[model samples]
Target: METFTEWRTWERARADLAARSLGPDDLVVLDRAVDAALRWHGDQRRPTGAPYAEHLFEALEVMVRGAGVTDLDTLVAVLLHDVVEDTDATVSDVEAEFGPDAAELVDWVTKPPAGGQGRQAKRVAKTAYLRRLREAPPDAIRVKLADRVSNVQTLDRMPPDFQRRYYLETVTYVMPLIELLGDDTGGWFSGWYTSWRRRFGHLG
Candidate 1:
């Protein structure tokens, strides 16, 4: 089994991404966004007990390096994608630091407003969020696809019941968004989804 040290290597593997040819301003913004994310998510851990920043970094690496996305706004948004959801940060904070485009992409990818909604209502809200991604800028959806790929890769490490629900949710609420990302990302999503379904489809 991979230890935490081994898992942590994923962060270091992004050195190649950091070394990629980027414009001066783009590199500056990427560094600033990464620094901010590290500060905001300080010592935070995921439910799987991994450092939360690892997930964010992995998503950014995939979107920027793997997907060949060099847009500064999209890259910055990828870094701050979970800030509003997991930290005390606000969309305004991201906008003030990064730009309106970054803030808007983050907002577009964020889960919908949750009120006194029941389970079904929450599911409906989630579905709505996925559908909204269809119209979202391709950059935002690309980051979301990277996030989903990371989550799906680790689903087995979660509780069995939770894993089952996540699988169903991915197929129902998330797959369509992947489908909408179009060809380049669609291929990645399909390959991951197919592998996941082979392993867990029996649960559904």
Candidate 2:
């Protein structure tokens, strides 16, 4: 499913969210989450040199447009998923701003500085994070799966080593979570990623 994952701008994404059957409070929360993300991620760039908000927008679009997700808190958490991990923001800061539900979901998906110093430590930390995702609530897993879909959708743009490594990580840990969902939407995501993996046959 080549669903449109790029909103290109937050205004465009906001418009799409508005077009949905959301109420005033939903719009307000979404707007605040977008503004907060813009402020906290100011001047940051993705590895591909794109504006950082582009990634957040892509994740939002994946959940909303691609996965048919409409939960207000999940959408909000998707918007701010990386803030606590990448910025100086804390879970408490998120809780103060967006309340507990969003904060807890974000915390579940946030990768801590778990393993410590070296490259091996970093790998261990990431591995642990992925493995621990098994215990995440469904909405939190939805956030993560959408985030990963956005990241992996452009795999051809990354280096070969990164592609293989990420593909392995995705199939090994991430796809299983989708399988656990045991529903049609989850099957759709799993199929889409499986086709993505097939497209880049070298990942096999």
Candidate 3:
């Protein structure tokens, strides 16, 4: 649990991007995506109280470092994945700025609105999202798998009840989606899921 500094996330993400050796054009696109996400998620915090951008960077890191993703559009989509869900940014805005493919990836990963309701509504929303992902493109599922990895990687920082429910959701909803990916990406997520389950499964 280190301090939530925006620079740290950029520093880490840049290092991973550099390792991939993206071309000049792709580098500029990734930078723009990062800038847009930072601007839109301004001053937002995660459940663990880290700056919201940290989660985005962590998700990208999981894809690059763990899953060996180097696709330019997928990486760009990773950067802007949450803007539509958490900020005022709309799907049309993402599509207009980042192009249809990247926007489509974000749209696939973004959960439907849960509204102001209890856990049941949120669970129903997530369940529906998972069903939709069953037929989503492999690349879209890759982003989602990486997102879940980043989320569950730090379960200790969350409350015991949250840990329990999230672990269940990951097993029930996410694992099946990972199966749909049918690539080594699913292996990466499964590794994380198994480790976290052993550590947190009893909390339920």
TM-score of each: 0.84, 0.95, 0.89
Winning model by lDDT: 2
RMSD of each: 3.3, 1.4, 3.2
Order by TM-score, highest first: 2, 3, 1
Tens-digit lDDT track for model 3 on 1-204?
A: 211122347866686577678777887888899999999999999887878888888888778877778898898888888889889999999989889999999998888898659988887887888878888898998888778777887777888878888888887877777677667777766666677677767765
RMSD of 1: 3.3
Error of 3 at 149 (Å): 0.9
TM-score head-to-head 2 vs 3, winner: 2
Candidate 1 whole-model C-alpha lDDT, 0 to 1: 0.75
User: 53-101 in candidate 1: lDDT tens per residue?
Assistant: 7787777666655556777888788889988877888899999998899
Clashes of 3: 0
lDDT of 2: 0.88
Model 3 earns a TM-score of: 0.89
Off by over 4 Å in 2: 1-3
